[model samples]
Target: MNIRTMPVVAVLAFAASCSAFAADSIKIGVSGPYTGGSSPMGASMRDGVRLAAAEINAKGGILGRKIELVERDDQAQNDRGVQVAQELINKEHVVATVGYINTGVSLASQRFYEEARIPVINNVSTGSLVTKQFLPPEFPDNYIFRNAANDTIQSAMIVREAIDVNKYTKVAILADSTNYGQLGREDLEKALAAKNIKPVAVEKFNVKDVDMTAQLLKAKEAGAQAILTYAIGPELAQIANGMEKLGWKVPMIGSWTLSMANFIDNAGKNGEGARMPQTFIQEPNTPKRKAFIAAYQQAYNPPNGRIPSPVSAAQGYDSMYILAAAIKQAGDTDGVKIRQALENLQEKVDGVVTTYDHPYTHDDHEAITMNMVVMGQVKDGHVVYANAADKANAVREKASGKAKK
Candidate 1:
């Protein structure tokens, strides 16, 4: 070849090599309780995130680069959550953040991200504190976004379902002392008043408490015909068992987190006949759900190939997809830009739980809604759709006339 042709070929070869060698991996930080008391819920978060990262990478990834999830075990502690988030933001230098099931941990760590200007794509923390920036004069331009349903919105739906749908005259509120449980109780009260109904009792318990007999007895004495609660992991099972042991057979409601497999396996038959609002439930036959279930089974199933908490896996999967979508939309991995893209997500996200339509916005930080939270009852050791739930939803809509548009 001529010298001129050789130079041109070398330039083209160099450019091609650079293109091929250009790394496309963008790191996203995932923190949850991989150990300690909240491990079941944390495992779900971790599994879901891994599956999502895998799916995105398999599909050519975001911006021709693969997505990498930097996972850490927070052990469900506020201090640990904060420390892990710092490592992700500073040491790992991830483009964005996700995970953290406990609100206390999420709240504790949010300030750091806000100051660092790194966006947090929160999947599990439901405390209104995440939106503390959006309140009044403190409106933040960008910082936090959530894919999971918030307690206020979910609890309001629970109360509406119980009073308007279930037609229960008297209800009880049983919640842990944490922000999640307390907010759930408060929202239920407001929803009750809005519908001209009242809860017969509102009781509180700690996260470590195993015996809720006294609390259940108090609620029963107050003429509570139905129970609505917000407690994570095995605590929820303990409450269900306590209620059944006391022979209270009324309809019960709680957070979608109760759908975790551990809660059902621990509560066993007692968990049956109980109802909880959920954003995603494994359906009959869908490619997405099937793939997720299959992956989880391969990783964590027993000799019988039985899996415990599929909900956690589903959440982790969906959260990662949502984060990837935001990153793709941004066309760059800057945390602030990604956060904006998430808030302005206008397209439909085919999540493991459901198809999210215009799920987030500047006006609303909480994405999932009552439509996302379908009421499911434990029947024959599986969570099945409650009978006539659609009819009840129609009644709720007619009664409330559409939640302020």
Candidate 2:
């Protein structure tokens, strides 16, 4: 009999065989906004995770089981994220999960993992409360850990850069209506308050808002020298475009979301010189970074050889390695054991971002700190170090801290 005309029972048997073969592999859920405005960050992060998983599996797999990613697109919606999280935990039976590029999604989705005791490594989500949702007082053990620089650190850096470095006294705060943007706006306000400075005008906008005329007008009327933003890329691009239309050009300093490809590409010339804190710039400064860039390029050929969102990609790559190390240390895929191992990682994990040494503990789940971050700028369609002095100072501080340790 021709294979194409196989019997129905034979086809079903072949499909069952494939499903059983897949079940033998260790499953990891990868959830993010893979097909929406946030796709730049989400897709880059997913690509980074895939790269690390491929590398790990090539080396005899992790704990003798091949790693398989069960990806789900959250579409940057809170309810969709919750559904994806439940499906990943219950149906997919993923031992652990990684990839949450949107803060709103992270906050809405991570509860399922906490309830199920499944470990989750948030690779790109920078919400301050993402990992703090379940603490010792509330819960016996927290199952969520993040590798990205949280909004607290990013907000402080942004305030410092605007006031201290650029000498902008009258700044305006522009944030979105989402939970991430609103919470980040509060953080920015607190950071400014610490310096005894208040924003000239505080404005809010919704996601996918094309016109930022009112927001820009308010800031311009308030004589704001710079604009501090907390929204994602598409809306951020609108801010830049609106500024250009109004013939008002001010420094756009904001969170790391400003480094997204969507913002840079959409804003075009208006997006140039925009600054933000970055955990990783794709400059190949270190040997590890060089190798990672080369590998990512080889695996996924991005535009102009750029890794789309460098910060997201690097954090995602490092997060996977950290998870692999924890899984290796635990010697099993048990969620509780994995959580314990992550809280106290024994070996040094040389990742694309930095050499993680005791990155987490019982009280702290933040892996990347302020010292490991540097100011990055959008220049010539790419993100680069904003200034040599800032980069050098951060490097020295990181090195000094490591020496003391």
TM-scores of the models, in the order given: 0.84, 0.92
lDDT of 1 by residue, 52-137 (tens): 66556556778998666677888888899889988988898888888878888888887788778777767877765666654545
For candidate 2, the per-residue lDDT at 235 reads 97
Candidate 1 has its poorest 10 consecutive residues by lDDT at: 391-400
Candidate No. with top TM-score: 2
Residue by residue across 44-152, what tens digits does model 2's lDDT show? 9987887777667657668898777788899989999999999999998999999998899999999999999999999999889998999877798999999998999
Query: With candidate 1 superimposed using the best TM-score fit, by how many Å does residue 356's alpha carbon deviate from the native?
Result: 3.8
CA error at residue 46 for candidate 1, angstroms: 1.3
RMSD of each: 8.8, 6.5
Index of the highest-lDDT prediction? 2
TM-score, structure 2 vs. true:
0.92
Clash number for model 2?
0
